[model samples]
Target: MTPSTENRPQMSVEDFEELERHASETVRLEFINGRVQAKPVTDGNHDQIIAWLQRLCMQHRPELWLYGDRGMKVERYRRGRARPDGVLAPFGFPAGHGDWSEAAGVLMAVEVTSHDSDTHQRDRVEKPDAHAAAGIPVYLLIDRDDRSVVVFNQPEDGRYRHEEKLPFGAPVKLPEPVSITLDTEPLKEFAD
Candidate 1:
């Protein structure tokens, strides 16, 4: 038999949590509002940039913390959840629940874009707001298709006051005292 084309109804946060509690797969999943969605599959190009950025942040190992493709629920005024491609916290959170809201207060969150329409929207809109509302200082968006990195800072009124995009090899200076380089070429291979 061939695959069915029917679409399932979106799930709620509780349902999402229950699913998480019982899941066995490794694919990334995220929830926004009440809709749970799967993160876009990472191509080699995506991994290259993620590895590059992570290595760039290696100097902060002692007090600095890094979480790759982890779920973080931003607790601003409301409770919103997101699993950013990566996260940085100068100091990781104390022993608490295993979720993002519990593991740490984010200094920065990174989202690596892919080909799905839903994936792109969740990364661009819902996740950014969640990070900002949670008082995260920076949000970096890596758009694989365009080979660019968008840096967001100075959260005000549920959105970042500063938004800047840099091309490949452009210097990205984060508040965490590190100079990272973002290259666009590596991602071009995964655009397929």
Candidate 2:
């Protein structure tokens, strides 16, 4: 699920950390710059897609670990902390957040698009900048809104130098990071 920053106030990283320490288990929050955006609940389709990608990545690398919406503190991006929908890290990286992990060991981050406008913008626009700035090698976006998948690779100067967008039925080729191709044929669209 993507986060919505509607009435959220900007909070410093220190303040955000303090808030997270005492945050309720019932409400999930992601701090970007100073905004506290509530993460939406994911549906079955969202869960299925995440699992599918995890399987694909794990199958190829075998040694890499995959995370689901773990709070990550991206040091290179500096000003923001993101809980990407999927985080692929080397074997020995913490499975969950005790403190924000530096984006150094992260091979790739995956974000599955949701229905809200704010969510869409966060996944499609804001996060790419943040992820690239964090020096993450690859960013994979499975966009429900467009019924397509896009891989952003070759991070440089705060952005990915290469982007390949493919419709659901086509294969998405990931470079470096994982260095494998993913089949999107199993993904199903939401019913109207």
Candidate 3:
């Protein structure tokens, strides 16, 4: 995805966390720049996709660690945050914090895009750059709007030069840093 050189929102640690203080159980917030916004609750279609992924990752437990929508705080250089719908990491990293702002051991991040246009854009663009900057090798986007999945790999200088999109029902190959072999067909039950 070619991003315009246009400025994207970048937030400080303090501003990034305003959501936790105000967000209700029904609304989930993710940080953007110095502001936080509510993310969409998945529709029936989207829920099926998430369930499919959850099952796939769990099947290979012990070898690979699977993480679901949770805050990740990467505080090393720039303090920021992200909550991926699914994260695949090698099992050896220290457990506890899934927040990218705290530690940078995340190997892969997968965000299942909802109908919200803004959230979709952030997941595809802003967060990928942050993940790359943190040295995350792979980023996957399960686009609900388009019924497709995109895998970005071959990170160079904090950006992915290689990207591939697999349409719904097609088999998707899980790359390095993740141990499972899967495609979207297994997850169709969650699709709307």
Candidate 4:
């Protein structure tokens, strides 16, 4: 007999932990609002930008920690559990965990868009609401399609009150919770 729909387990932190328990080093997945998602394959452009940001954060803010592909706990029940491309957290705070880190003490989250349209939509549209709801102080999105970086801040009522976009050649200023001017010159756009 087929399992009843109600009996099937919805994606949650428990599932996330189970996946993490058996996942290979290369496996990358995200749990969002009872939906489990496989992260799209990242390209050179993605790696380049992440490396630049990592180095930049290290240089500017030696006291904090910048981690890649770290999972965060957003809500208590539904629509929680996000693993951003990069996360900047306070010193001594646990950045990696078996399940998910509580959103508290998280300074910022970053997403480097993939070429896939669905990935782009999720990064551009869906994640901001989730991150804002988590009360993360800042959210940075690097859009490969547009070769631009968008910063979201001032989370209130599950949405950001401010947004600023800058082209790849321009710098994006990270607002309070952390203070630093990101240099985007090293971030290269995908070749046409």
- Candidate 3 positional error at 90, Å: 4.5
Error of 4 at 45 (Å): 2.7
lDDT of 1 by residue, 31-137 (tens): 66556667767777677777866766765354656667676776464455667778876554533546545424567888888877775568777777777777778
| Local accuracy of candidate 3 as per-residue lDDT tens digits, 107-187 | 678888777768556878877776665566788888766778888877767678789988878988867766466766755
Q: Model-by-model lDDT, in order?
A: 0.67, 0.79, 0.67, 0.79
* Predicted structure 3: clash tally: 18
Q: Enumerate residue pairs that collide in model 1.
A: none
* lDDT tens digits by residue: candidate 4, 24-58: 76767776655666777677768778888888888
Task: Name the better of 3 and 4 by TM-score.
Answer: 4
Better of 1 and 2 by lDDT: 2
TM-score of predicted model 2?
Answer: 0.87
Worst 10 residues of 1 by lDDT: 175-184
Flag regions of model 1 displaced more than 4 Å. 1-12, 60-62, 91-95, 176-192
Clashes of each: 0, 2, 18, 1
Question: What value of lDDT does candidate 2 attain over all alpha carbons?
Answer: 0.79
Off by over 4 Å in 3: 1-11, 74-76, 90-103
Q: Using Cα atoms with residue i matched to residue i, what is each candidate's TM-score against the true structure?
A: 0.77, 0.87, 0.78, 0.84
